[model samples]
Target: MLGLIKKDLLIIKNNIKFAIIFIVVFVCFTEQSSELLYFVPIFLSTMLFISTFSYDDYNKWDAYACTLPQGKKSVVKAKYLASLLLTLMAVLITLILGFIIGAINKNFDAKEMLEIISGVVVAIVLLQSIMFPLMYKYGVEKGRIGIFLGVFGMSGLIGFLFKYLNIKIPNNVIQTFNDYWFIILPIIVILMILVSYNISKKIYLKKEF
Candidate 1:
């Protein structure tokens, strides 16, 4: 499992230079948007990690991996663990960059920056939790398309419901969420990943190749 985790992490490490360049360019072009600084790293890390699935499929890694003891379980568990590590590294990079940018701009608000980073991390984790199971059940190519359409369809449905149903969130509720999101979001994300991991593991183990 450790070897498997290292293999995926090495893949990300090799490709991260390009991600860094793109992030730097984005920062230079949109210096005003600190939120983007926090978001792009985590988003890119997620993409980079997802790309490993394509690589695995292309190399036929799964079929070979299943020959090893606990192979399917190792692959799935390593993937989730590697993703968490990459996310933490991305967040750390973003945190450092946020501080540097804040210092340069002379408008540094530690609390605000932390909040934005936390929110972005939570959102990305939620996305990954949804997508991972689909990717495990279907291969990466189909999974990507499914995720796109699913997100679009879900967004449209929510918007339609909001517009037609006149559903309004109370200010008090919003404030309550704002007050407790730091505590609540982590719990939700943890539960999501655990469920997602189990689903993905089951799917992978049942899969023939």
Candidate 2:
């Protein structure tokens, strides 16, 4: 498991320049928008995690790795674990960046920061819940398309519902979530990730190669 994780890390290390560029662009553009800035770390982490799939596909690593002792289940678990690790790292980085920005601007809101972090965590988990199964079932190229369509389709549907149906989320509901998110959200995210991992593992087990 550790070796598998190390392999993914080496892949990321090989592509560190792209990660650096992404962080630079995110920091520059999002400095003024705290809400959007909150998403930067998780977004980068998720993107980096997905890029590892592309690397494995390009290098034909998956087929070769399955021949080794760790096997497909370990591979799937490694990816999921790597995603969790990267997300945590990203969250930490965002916290530090938030502190620096708040210190500079002298406009810190702990409640808002907590809300943003919670939102990012939920978003990343939801994305992975959709993405990993597709990637395992269809491989990276098709999975990337699935991810694009899934995200935009969901966003468009939500927008349409909001615009035409006038479906509004109540403030109290948001407040309830914000109040109990530290307790509720982590449990929800963990359950969702576990389900996603099981689905991915099943898909990977059935995959020939």
Candidate 3:
């Protein structure tokens, strides 16, 4: 399983320009505050997860993977795991770069770091809830619409809620994320992903290989 994941990561490492832009934007913005930095991981994860399906289509590797002893379910699980791993690495890079930029300017703080981490976590959960099922149901070509809609619709709602609605949400979501339910939150995310994986595997399992 780990070998399969490494193989998948190596494939993605081949085209990292998209990942590069996220870092570039992080530096260009100059704020390097957690609020601004949080979005980097969120955005990177979704784009790359969607690509999980796209790459499979582009390379026509599904047939090849299906022939492996671990079977189709493991192939699908490997993709999800690879996405999570890459997403974590991306988040780490963003944090390290953000920290450097912040230190250079002497502007970084702990609460801000919490906010960034919370924002990324929330974004990952929301994205997986929307995209994973769509990818399972529609595959990449048809499912990109769902991704666009999920991405844009959330963007608009956030704009309206914060910009126009003026329904101010306290920073507690970030400030005290680990204070009470932090452990449960990740467990829930893992369970959700597992559930999604089971469903996706069941769906793809029946498809002609």
Give the top-scoring candidate (TM-score): 1
Per-candidate local distance difference test: 0.89, 0.86, 0.73
Could you tell me every candidate's TM-score relative to the true structure? 0.95, 0.88, 0.78
Is candidate 1 or 2 superior in TM-score?
Answer: 1
In terms of lDDT, the best-performing candidate is 1
Error of 1 at 117 (Å): 1.4
Taking the tens digit of each residue's C-alpha lDDT, what string does model 3 give over 117-179? 756775686677667767767877777788888799989998888898798767886667657
Weakest ten-residue segment in model 3 by summed lDDT: 29-38
Model 2 residue runs over 4 Å out of place are 25-32, 161-175
Each model's Cα RMSD? 1.3, 2.3, 4.2
In model 2, the worst 10-residue window by lDDT is 27-36
State residue 143's C-alpha deviation in candidate 1, in Å. 0.4
Candidate 1 — number of clashing residue pairs?
0
lDDT of 2 by residue, 102-186 (tens): 8787888877997889888898899989998998898898998999999999999999999999999999999998688798899
lDDT of 2: 0.86
lDDT tens per residue, model 1, 1-209: 99899989999888889998999899999877687677889999999999999999999999988888878779999999999999999999998999899889888888988888888888888789889999988889999998999888988999998899998889999998899988988898899899999999888889997
Ranking by lDDT: 1, 2, 3
Better of 1 and 3 by lDDT: 1
